[model samples]
Target: MLSIALLGLLVVSAAASPSAIKDRTGRVVHKRTTEIVQLYAYGTNISGLPIYAGSDNLAYLATDDAASNFTAVTWTIDTTGTDAWTVSANTTAATNSSTLSSGSTFYVVTDSSSDDSFAQAGFVSDASDAPSGATTTGIVTYGPYVMILEDTDDKDTYVSEFWATQSDTDGVWTLMWNEAGTAQDNSVPVTLKTTAPVV
Candidate 1:
């Protein structure tokens, strides 16, 4: 499936900020102003690799130079002071799957939902079967960072970063969180790490 390596997903939102103001009676009051600004651009990872939104709507690691022309990768977030949850820019809206897949090692990206931490370990060769609501370009995103399970068989939570190996099927990668080290996929591996899309 296709994804935005150089994602041109720019989000301009009107945010509110309070500024102090003095009243005629010499009393101080807080005033508000709404302005439109660029919230964030989902850029490359610390390894300088661009991120891609898979057809499943989740974020994935992009192969180097896979999307060079793209300048910015923007992701949406709903912040409640301490926490921020990822949102899809083009999907109809949904939440993360509470139940894990039976055989799939990783959760598929879905524009219809909100995912905390997850990555697209596999890619569908066919775009028509994708759940991003449109074409493969519209993908799902997790909050702050893009991550995967700790291991193929673990499936408990996500880890920060590590080297990943490319699957023999091409476009697919085996994911894991190795606080100790990197995981292997057969004899080959696609070295990748998920990080905050903030630029």
Candidate 2:
């Protein structure tokens, strides 16, 4: 079976905010704007050496050279049952069960409407059916950062950076996330943290 590990999968909704306007009578009026929802393009192979992270507030897994390319990695979340949760990456017949050399790097980037203390962890690998090797990416490294989108006409600008990593002890890559639904509706927030293995 082909498997992958998802590093950082997060869904964030723009919270409601009031716009103040001055009336002729010297009174202030507050108006709410429409809420926008979006999805990420990051997926991980739990059994693979290459992990994943969130880019542009969505799921994305990309290399260092093409770090800004958000579409590099794509994944879909499935929540069929209470205990049944999984995340799958779109792979071709040729890429499936492929091998990832050591020293490979994966990055996860995101944007937010507010400066949030984003925290993530639980680095899992995907299942695999590939040939076993001797040496693996002993330990994977992850880096998280934010890119501000200031070209918009609105002042409600936000961005976030997050990342994670793992080691390929078996020298095979075929991992993915066993988490549920993608792009969640975050009505409330509690806390955030980040974790991973060192090279």
Candidate 3:
């Protein structure tokens, strides 16, 4: 009985192979390769802020869904053709830092090596009232790596800006999203990385 079960399992595994398929003409059919490679990462939020402070090359996507705040999230990365991607970060080489307003969106991309930090510089200011803290939630993930920026900002803004960044670095690229100005009360730092083709 054991021998029979083992034999059956072997047969099933063999049949699952792509080469096992055949056409009516008695020719073997090959499976087409997937064009896009997707990467994923997940983490928890602290005090309404989402942080991705670990070892991985994941980038964060900014979103505006209120119900999705401060929860586990799955982010996807689709790429083909070349190893490098062109994308933008709110912080640049010149400014090298910026403030994430109370209801704004931003992104952070890290490399395979180095520490990455994604944090708010200070509470969003309102001239007529007290400073407003950013109330957002979601996960920054891992595997290869991922960082998620949570807020009630426009999702399209982040997507469009990412496309623009890709346009800037058509072949090779680096992403930066460091916060500048006054550091918040609960700011935590982590590893950062630059994303290029996996070449």
**Best lDDT among the predictions, by candidate number:** 1
* Root-mean-square deviation of candidate 3: 18.5
lDDT of 2 by residue, 107-131 (tens): 2212223323132321123223211
The better-scoring model by lDDT among 1 and 3 is: 1
In angstroms, the error of model 1 at 194 is 10
RMSD each, Å: 17.4, 21.0, 18.5
RMSD of 1: 17.4
Candidate 3 ranges with C-alpha deviation above 4 Å: 1-70, 79-177, 181-184, 192-199
State each model's CA lDDT, in order.
Answer: 0.32, 0.24, 0.28
Estimate, for each residue in 27-137, the C-alpha lDDT of model 1 and write its tens digit. Answer: 343442222111221222323344334444334444433432211223332221111222222222232332212211222342234423223333233444444522223
> TM-score of every model?
0.29, 0.19, 0.19
